[model samples]
Structures are given as structure tokens and as C-alpha cells.
Target chain A: MSKNDKKQQVETTGHEWDGIQEFNNPLPRWWVWVFYVTIGWGLWYTVAYPAWPLLTGATEGYKGFSTRGQVAADIAAVEAQNAPNNAALAASDLATLQTANPALYSYAVNAGGAVFRTNCVQCHGNEGMGATGYPTLSDDDWLWGGSVVDIAYTVSNGVRNESSPDARFSQMPAFGDILSNEEIANVVAYVRALSGQEADATAAAAGQQVFLDNCSACHGEDGKGDRMVGAPNLADALWLYGGDAATITQTVKNARFGVMPAWSEAFRDGGLTQAEVNAVAIYVHQLGGGE
Target chain B: MSQGDTPLYAAREPIFPKRVSGRFRNLKWGIMLFTLGIYYLTPWIRWDRGPEMPDQAVLVDLAGRRFFFFWIEIWPHEFYFVAGLLIMAGLGLFLFTSALGRVWCGYACPQTVWTDLFILVERWIEGDRNARLRLHRAKWSLNKLRLRLTKWVVWLLIGLATGGAWVFYFTDAPSLAVALVNGTAHPVAYTTMAILTASTFFFGGIAREQVCIYACPWPRIQAAMMDEDTITIGYRGWRGEPRGKASDPNAGDCIDCMACVNVCPMGIDIRDGQQMECITCGLCIDACDDIMTKMGRERGLVDYLALKDETREREGMKKTPIWRHVLRPRTIFYTALWSAFGLAMVFALFVRADIDITVAPVRNPTFVTMSDGSIRNTYDIRIRNKNGEAHKFVFSQTSTERLWLSVEGSEARVVEVPADQMLQVRVYITADAGSPAATAERTVLRFWVQDLESSERASADSYFTGKVR
Candidate 1:
């Protein structure tokens, strides 16, 4: 390289003892311009947004934008979109709601999936498989009734609750005072035969008249049970009290009444809207047995 | 320029940060892999917490105000556990810094890791130091534009991922991922992503070293924490001075290779002295050693050494042993302080209660007289249930006045409270009027609540009163 070609336009720090040399050049033009632009941008940002904290809160800047306000607006927008389907769900009856609007039904089912996971998964298994005491919602047989209206009614006004006037109330009588031990055993045999389970033929034969005289008032003579009274159908495989002989005998001797505190009074008195209850009922209904 | 202007020293130029390879680099790579891997994978793991609770292994349910780890579930009132974790982190940082200077800052700091990642992306798209410098000096071209755009896209994606991972800590990760891809994630997620993306671009991409040197308080605080005995990345002036190139055969051991300057991320020549921007990352040591090996010179031109030992060597004092300097009074004190805080936090967390109570008295009209010659007072009581079941809160006050307490709105004394919900009730207390005297008598009234089935009893206290009779 020629000496003139190496004439350094920018002088170095000149104390270089090795290949490393410090250039005394000014800052690059683009970098300095960008630095200025950034400063200007910072000022603009401070003025246009709530950047500084004040004694009360933050300054309401020119744009008046906030993280909270933005979030609220976004949530409202999404809710507005879902409002029509929610309205349709509110207007229709439970049975008609499912069949009339396919889209709404699909949406409700999807919505119910999460709500069930949140609320009903505790006692009723995650998938609505019953535990020892908890009744399964997935089966066709129900302690109450399986019809959509019946299911909805039972859910709204739970069993054995005096607060709701319409709750299907039936408590098996405590026959300890009325019937002898032998009679209680005979009745257990009669109940077993009614369900088509194993039973002593002779005792069941003698106990048929006893059931006709006492149990037929709530439970029909055919043992089909009165839905209004919430007596279980003795003919069905499902047993509300129990199928085992010991449990059956004990139940007959001293009644077994499981209390489900009224949910309607709680929901109504608690000031929750019908839509909210319906949302929850529909959620619970879909857990196992919903058609 | 005047003599005063030229008197002291030159402002340090940016370190061109040359690349190097060694055992320390390998260790750093290993740690980076392990930490980043854990962060990305931890959210997807599931735990079978029965059918009742959420299944995500590690989740912070913001709406539920519950934190779920694999086995331990934390409620809002039990926030001491979180505080304990933060305290442990602080202590751990102190202990680590006391042993090795700025090691955490150099390697594990989020800023450092992200900056390293940004640098990698920059290198991939814009080429390394010399190539970048040449390109910058060159006029703008279509090729340069394409490279710059590609680099920005990658950087933005990394920023989005960072924001994405952060939101996962607040919600269920897999569900959020699905929601995000389906455009169903909360708008807050998008906003957070934007903010994070901008920050990553500014901090990691542009203001890299400025954050460490001028903005961060850590380097300033660390100056006070360090002492003469602390091991810092230092150039051995005793061996490296009288600097000259190896071509000049009579030069000192340094050979004036400039390898150290080339490899420093901050661009400061280590031979000048330690500066605030130096992260003590030991890259210079690696660079210097490589040069030394190539030049047939003994290594360690730049090494981790104590200031006292360096000074002693300069003053012709006998060289002190390495182990003697490590166990100083400052390190011992720091260790003790760190442990004390750690142990105290652990102790507090274990004993902290899940349930907390706050009682408010109706102050507008403090007392009233019933027609039956009884004094009455009203209280608004709130009960919160932390357990996963609806509980019955029974009302009975501790006043010996046969204080018949009854809730006004509900008939039954037993009130039902849902899981993780607070139930507020207005309770009225009445007593035989003539038996109580004075307006401001302080009598502690106890309210006991039992989970009827679980037999778990929780008690709270309030006061009973009557006007002067």
C-alpha cells in the first residue's frame, strides 16, 4: 500500500504498542441520530401515555389508555359476541332448548363441560362415575326421575328440602315401632323380589299383601312408584336405599332418608338470576345423564 | 482541547467481544440448556390431583387465587410460602456472589441470557464482529435489508415466546397455547406479548451493555460487597506490561496479542483495569490463554486473582497462598446473614395459617334497645372458607349475659358458605338490658364455626356492648 493511501483521515490515540489502536473518531451519524430520535420518542411516549406516578395515582395522559380499561373493553367485546347464544339459551325451555337450536345446544354442552369440571367433579367423579354414597348422573336409572323436566326440577329444588314446596319429598317410614323384626325381614324379602334380585320365595309371597297395604299408597300397587312422591321404582335395577339384604332390612326397620338441601331457595334467596341457576343446572345435568 | 480536558484518561471504547471456546464456555452452555429446558417443559407436565382439583402440575390460578405445585397447594392467605421462596432466592444470590464475584450476573441473569440469545441471532443473520463492522461501513444494499428483516423476525418470535411462557405461569399452559393459536386467548395475552416484544427489542437488542453499566444498581451495590481479597477477572500487570507484539521477540509474556480485547463483550481492554461494565465472565482469560498457548508462553495472562496478591507482587512482597484469601471475614459474615434469613423464612412458612379473619363493627348506630328491655348491637361479619367444601358456620357468641345472637335475614343459625368464597352476614346480639352498663365496655365475643362433618372448628373474636344504662 502507498504511503498517501494510508494517510489516516481520523487520528488514533497514538500510544499503540501493538496492533490494537483507539480511533478518535466521532460517534457514527446514524447512531447519534437514532439516539436523538429515541429521546424524542421518550418524550412523546411520556406525554401520550400514563407514564409517571403521581400522589393520587398516575397522570391521565393525552390518550388516557390503561391496561385495566383495555382489558375491560376486550372482555366486554367477547361477552357481547356470546350474548345472542346466551339469550337463546335463556328463552327456550330445557328440553326445547337442546333440540330447537343445534348451535346453542352445542355451545351449552361445551360450556357445561368446563363448569362440570369446576363444580360437580368433587363428589360425582370427574366423568360422573358415582362414588360409594354419591349417585351417578350418567345412568338411565335415577333415584328421582330421568325426564328433562323432572331432572331440571329436582336439581332446582333438591330432595328432602322443606323450603321448596315442590320438592319431591318421600321418607321411608321407620317401621321399628309398627313392624316386628320378622315382619321387617319379610318386607326386605318382598323388596328384593320386586327388584328381581335373590329372595326367599315363601317370605316374598307372604310379604306381597303387606306391601299392598302399606307401601302402595306412595309406591303404586305395581311398585312402579309415584314420581311426584319421589319413591324409587322397585321394579328397576337401581335401588335408592340399597339392594343388599342387611341394608334393606335395616332400611325397613328404621327408614333411610338422604337429605339434599334445597338449592332453589339458596339460588333464589341468594339473589342469583335464573340464567345463572340454569347455567349451573344445565352444567350438572350434562355431567352424566343428559340426553 | 485544554490541558484539563486532556488530563486524565480516554473514555473506553466498546469491546468487540471475540468468540472463544473452553471448559468454562462448555459449562456455561450446559447451564443455559438445563435452565431454559426446564422453563419451557415444566408447564406441560400433569399431576393427578384427584378429580376435584386442577390437573396442571405447576399452575398459578389467578382467578382462583390458588397456586398448585405437584403436591402442595397454596392459597392466598398462605402467601408466606411465596415470600419464603423469594427470601431463599435472595439468600442464595448473596451466597453465590460472596463466593464468586458477579457469577450470576455474568451467566444466569435473564438480561444476560436474553442478550446472549439476541447476539446469537444477530450473528446468524448479520455475521460476526469483523463482518458486521465491514457491512456497517458499506453502503446499504438489498442483501443487508433482507438480513436485517430476517434478524428482526427471529428476535420478535423469541420475544413472543418469552411473553407466552410468562402468561403460562398465570393460566393453564396447554389450554392457553390452544387458545392462543385459535385466537381465543385473552387480549391481555396479546398486549403482554406486545409489551414484552418491545422490551426485548430495546433492552436485549439495542441497550445491551448500557443496562449493566449505567441502569442497573447491582454493579454499584456489588462494588461495596467486594473487597481486596475478592477474586475478579484481572490482567496480571506484573507479567503483561511492557506490552509488544510477539514479532518483537523482547516483549513481555503478553505478546500484546489483543486477543483479550477482541473477546470481551463490553469491549473494554482488560489490560487497562477492571471497570464497571465488566461482568467478570472470564472470556478474556480464555482468550489470553489461547494466545499464550499459541505463542509458546505460559498461560494465565488474564486470570481470576485477588487485588492484595496482585499488589504484593507489584511491591515485591512474598506471594500469598490462594486458599488464605478465600476465607475472609466478609465472606463469613455474608454466609451467616444469608443462612439466618433462609432459616427464618422456612420456619415462618411452616407455621403460617391458611385462614385469616377481620371483623368490623357497625359504628353509625353502636347500640339499640329492644322492647323486651334488652340491649342490642349489630355486627357485619365475613367468613372465608379455604378448604374445598361448602361449610356450615354456626353463630354463638361468648358473652355470659345469655347473649342470644341471631342472624337477621336467615332463620337458621347455621349458614352455608361455598368453597373458597367469603360469606358476609349481619349478626345482631341481644342481652338483658339492666345487667349491662357503660357505653364503651369492651367484652370479647367469640364466634365458633365447625365443619359439621369434618369436625374442623375455626373461631373468631368480636366485642359486645350497650349504651350507659
Candidate 2:
């Protein structure tokens, strides 16, 4: 507390807080050395890498690094790396593509997924579950076979359309003009009974003869419906339309014929290329049900 | 000595640690040689891990995302083994530090070893302590410049080797060396070498003990890790206090020869008492012991002594055994933890799966209604084959009687996953009219993949998304 006990004042920055004076001390030797080293490093970095800005353009340092150039190089490298896989995919048969090279198969599946989202999702639902009257693409039940090549063919030519000359064109006769309403009802009941739907036994018995005579040409015996003609099997539990008495009667009266657009480049509406058609076919075929 | 004229930030007082012949010095020499030998030669050793994998005994394949060590190969997912090893190393340092104070820094640390090597080269070219100090005070001459240039060139060569050895661990050593000579190696390799070389030369040659005193945080943190029982080199103040000339018979055992001060690498006087800068290499003890023997006095004026034992000796009690200092609670704890971590990592390595299967159900539309009226669900199946040999697996599913499963592109129910690759295949599963899951909106489907040769099976469960019929 005595004035004599007070230490001699050192050089200060002329500032004091709570009686504590700030001393004008020099930096430590190691700290100064470290600062000098960083300054040297900064000078070297400016000389060796893209750094300072000028009036017209920035100075390209010795390395001449650029973000755009790096990106272009990276993209080029990736494309070069994938060129072999693309070639393999182009050469392989559509049916064997999945098993031949898994790398290319994955690439096709991924690329096909994108094409399916853009072109095929409208009628087939988002995941190809299919709305009413539209065939479910994800299922194993294929009216024209679920083989990859078969799907590819169907995708290329389409069905029941005048657009493609090679299209699968088969139509059921609308017996409404030839037969009476009673005969149409009987046939409907028989078809419903074949698929194990509730139906009138007497009516089904009488309708069997009419079906054998009129529909057996395309639907075949036992009503299995021949794949050669793309006729759906009536004996199975599946139906394109409702299987009720009224719905089937309407179907037989009108003769349901759903039309799919040909994805081949030969068709209109900006049809896909052969590669794209193959991609979408592979996509739809592999959605859990491609045979 | 006037306070007003003294510099707050003093210039570095250069150190020239005199040569000493003692057991600790010999131990240091052996450790340095062994460590440097292993570091420089490890990348050159080769081990055949079959034709599919790299042959280098120790390699860090950064591009391939694999680490190869002798017979063991580590994938990216197995990085926990590396983490465990790092934890064990940390605990090992703790264990050693609790028993022997700063022994890692004293002998085995890269900083200490490299600095010692640099100093050895400096003494070889310029001469020993007195001669080097004299040369420093003298004016610049052709002889001095020649000696200095030779020393720097040798130092630079050592730095180059150190940097070169580091980069070799990440690549095939011989091929990389050839590429380096041909200027065909990756620029990153050369840049890394330049950075490392510069740092090694600067820290080992110029910075030296300054790093331990100023830059490194270990000395500050380790003070809390030590206790009174930990062994550290210290001057026996009781025996050597009031340090008087040897002619005075009343003086303590210490002759005040200043031998310990002349030989200290840290430029500290041991007689000043215990300080943070001591690495505990025990060279001062050897120098002082030589002086003691020449004067016909008892040795250990400056020696590896525990603070507690020193206090006890001052109180006229018998010094306890060295084992008592080493065998204590913290050291035992650290040792036990380090061992436990090592054991756990080993156990994990043995039980790791060689085959893994994962299934992801397509959830966009979930299920589609087939023409045959069967409910179908799509699942993406990924099978990973971790083995070196190629293998085929039987693909099957567990479900009700009406459910049938098949891999994409084939109805054979067999799939092949190549060696060290993942095969992603879309699997279509159809559930017939009477299946139980057909009526449920969603259900867990178990898909199995069994190796044809080993019968080792792996299964994955995914929700089979469907609609109620």
C-alpha cells in the first residue's frame, strides 16, 4: 500500500483499466518467426497458384488452376470411363442384358428408370401398378408374354393400332349387332363362372356352346385364351375390366380393345429411339414381373 | 543484470549438448536406429495376398479405398479397426507417461530423434561444443562457409529421405520411385514431399528444442498427467545446495563443476530445480557422475529420482523401490483399457461378415395387379461378395404356398455375384389369389441367398408393398 512498494512504470500504450496498465511489449521471437514464415508461404502461394485479381482478369499463377477447367476434365474422365460399359450395353441382346454384365445392367436399369418416369408413368401409375383397364406392368401376368424380348417387341410395335404395320392386331367381334341381349348375358355368366366368379349355373351351361362356337377361334378351348393372338385368359382370376355380370356383358357387347402407342421412332408424337424403347421395356419388364 | 536494460523477448541462446557415454544414451541410440530402420524399410517389404489384392505388406490404397497390412485387408466399412488402434496408441502413451515422465519425448519422439541426428551431423562437420561455439564467435571464412554448406547439404538429404519414405507407404514403392525419377508421378505426391521435407529440415535443424519449449502443447498438458511418484531427472538439491568451490571443505557433495549445465540440450541448469523443459534422458546424471568419481565422492548428484523419494531422503527416510513407483493405479488403468480395446477389435475382425445381402422394396406404386390376377411386388436386391474367389448363390424366398419368387432375367433361381463386387438385381415376387399376404396391404418378405459351395446363407427382410385384394 506504500508508494515505495509500487513497481517502476514500464513503457505503456497510454491506456489503463481498473488500474492495470497495458505494456508496449515486443512480440516473442518464435511468434515473429512464425509470422515471417507464413508471410513467406503466402508469397510462394500467390506465385504458385491462382491468387490476385487484376483489372481485366485474375492472375493465373504457375499452376493455372481453374474451377471450370477442373469440372470439364472430371466430366471428360467420367465419360471416358463409362464408354466401355456403354458399348457393352449396346452390343448385348435385350434378353441377356441383365445377366451378361451386371455393371451395364445397373446402368440400363437406372437410365430406364428415368425414361419410365418421363414417358410411361401416366397410364401405368407411378410404380406401374396400372389403373383400371390399363394392364399392370409390374405384375407377372402378361397378355403377350413377359419375356424381355417379347416386351421389347410389344414396346416397339404396340397393339391394336393402325400406326404400325406389324402391330399385334386382333379384335373380338361385337356380337351386339348379331346376337340378342339374352345371348350376350349368357356368355357373360359363362365367362364369370370360368374365373370362379358368382354366376347363374343354367345360364353358364347354355352359354358354353355359344362361347365354343363363336370365341374358340381366338380364346381356345377351356377358355385359356391363346398367347399367339394376345387374348387374355378368361379361366384365370384376372380381368382387364370388371368381372361382374353387367361389366363382362358390356365388355362382350362392346368388344374391349385397348390401344398402346408404339415407342419406336417410326411412330409420331416424338416416339423414342430404339435405345430408349429398349430402356423403357427393360424398365417395365424388370419391375418384378418380366418373365 | 539491470532490470531496465533487460530484453523482454530474448534472442535464442544456442544449445550444444556435449557428448555423454551412459546407459540412457546407449538406449536412446538403439531405439533411434530401430525406429528409423522400421520406418524407412516397411514399404519395401512384400507379402502375397493372392493375385487379386496388393502385394505390399503395409499399404494405404487411398484411391482403392482399401488398407492392406500383411495378411489383413481392411475395407472402408472396417475403419473401426483403425479407430480402435488409435485409441490404444493414445492409452499406451498415457500408461507410459504415468510411470516414466516424458520418456516418449526424451528418446522415441520423432522430434527428439531427428534433432539428435541433425546435431550429430553438425558436430561431425563443425566440431564439438567448445569448438563450435568458438567457430560461431569467429568471423566468416572460406573454411567456415564450406563446413556450413556441407552440414546443410547433409541435413537436406536426410529431410528428403524422410519425406520420400512417408509417401511410399501410400503407393507401390518401387514403381512410384521410378515414376518420381521420371517426373511422371502425380503432382500431389511431389507437393506432399516438398511440404514434408521443408518442415522436417526446419523443425529438426533450426527449431530443435524450441519446439518442445514453445510450439508443442504436450509439456503443458502432461504436467497434469504426472504425480510426485513419476520418475524425472532432477538435481539432488539437499546434497548439492549452497554449491561452493571444491577447495572449501565445508561445501556439500556437489563440487559446483557446472558439467551438467554444459551438456544439457535444453540449455537449462539442472541446479535450478525441476523444470518443464527436461526430457529426462539422464545425460546430466552421467556427466555429473563422472565428476563425482573423479573427486572420490558418492554419485547421483543429478539422477532419475522421484520427487516424493527425494523429499523422503531429505527427511532421512530410506528410498522406496522403483517398482513401487511404476506399479500404481493410473498406469494399471491405462494398460487395462488399452488391452481391452485391442481385444475387442480382434474379436470384431473374426466375426465380420464375408457376404452381405440387402433388399429395398420399390415403394412408388407398391404392388401391381397382374393379368393372372396375382399380386406382384418389386424388390431391388443387392448382394455383396467380400471374398476374393467368385461365387454363385441360390436365390429363394420364404412365403406362403401361392407365392413364387424369381430373380430378374432368369427363372433358374440361381444368381452369380462376382468376387469383390456388388450385384444389384430386381426380383419380382408374385402372390397368387389365396396367399395370405395378398390380402394385406404390406408385409415383411424374407429373401435368402445361400452360397452354392459353402452353404453360408444370408437373408434380408423388406416390406412387400401390395394392395388388399
Clash tally, candidates in order: 6, 1
lDDT of 2 by residue, B58-131 (tens): 99999978898886778777898899888998888888887899989999999999998998899899999888
The DockQ score of candidate 2 comes to 0.37
Please name the candidate that would achieve the greatest lDDT relative to the true structure: 2
**Pairs of residues at least 3 apart in sequence or in different chains that clash in candidate 2:** A288-B428
Q: Cα miss at B170, model 1 (Å)? A: 1.8
Q: What is chain B's TM-score across the candidates, in the order shown? A: 0.87, 0.91
On the 0 to 100 scale, the lDDT of residue B378 in model 2 is: 76
* Residue B118 miss distance in model 1 (angstroms): 1.4
> How large an RMSD does model 1 have?
20.2
What is the alpha-carbon lDDT of model 1 when measured against the actual structure?
0.72
Model 1 per-residue lDDT tens digits across residues A1-291:
454444465587775766766767778899999999999999999999998899998877899899999999998997789777767665668766655765576576666555556655676665455555566565445677765566657766777777777666888788888887777778778988887789999999888888888888878898877776767677765554457899878777777777664555354465323444455556555433444
